[model samples]
Target: YDSCVNSVSDPSIFVIFEKHQVYPEYLIQYTTSSKPSVTPSILLALGSLFSSRQ
Candidate 1:
């Protein structure tokens, strides 16, 4: 839950959940696949955040 993270990507909570390592089913509840259109850069940014957290 970082303030800076809120504004990044699509501003969708689903993106944030994936960033935090949540399950895809969980994401489905919050968002549909039709939206957000996953991108490599978003994953990279989340990966960086994950490693930093560890």
Candidate 2:
């Protein structure tokens, strides 16, 4: 059970958009996931981080 939960929570499932040039329009497509592996807070944090670089 622990292993299954850990696997599901694995943040690696999300693509590192910061590594590539991405526009706001396509951000939804990359961030959307059917598995619900990521939380909205995490996405907001990443969004701020990426925006800070620009």
Candidate 3:
């Protein structure tokens, strides 16, 4: 996928975004029991790591 990011929502996702130097709007909140993840947890993680520092 061109311009698409592979997300994992397990803090590991940050590696991809950080490496690419851009943030994906969505994140998959993968959990120890969740199936096909999605929701606020992932979003918060993304924001925590990728959002503008200023």
lDDT of each: 0.61, 0.57, 0.61
Q: Model 2: how far is 10 from its true place, Å?
A: 41
| Per-residue alpha-carbon lDDT of candidate 2 for residues 12-42, written as tens digits (9 for 90 to 100) | 3433335444344544435555785889999
Off by over 4 Å in 2: 1-36
**Candidate 1 lDDT by residue in tens digits, 15-36:** 3433555435544335456565
| Reference-based TM-score, model 2 | 0.33
Query: What ranking emerges by TM-score with the best candidate at the front?
Result: 1, 2, 3
Q: In candidate 3, where is summed lDDT lowest over 10 consecutive residues?
A: 8-17
What are the RMSD figures for all models against the true structure? 21.9, 21.3, 19.7
Model 3, 1-54: lDDT tens per residue? Answer: 333435545443333334565666898785486567779999999898876676
Which model scores highest in TM-score? 1
Clashing pairs in 3: none
Among residues 3 or more apart in sequence or in different chains, the pairs in candidate 1 whose N, CA or C atoms overlap within 3 Å are: none
Whole-model lDDT, model 1 = 0.61
Error of 2 at 9 (Å): 42
TM-scores for all candidates: the values are 0.34, 0.33, 0.25
Q: What is candidate 3's local distance difference test score?
A: 0.61
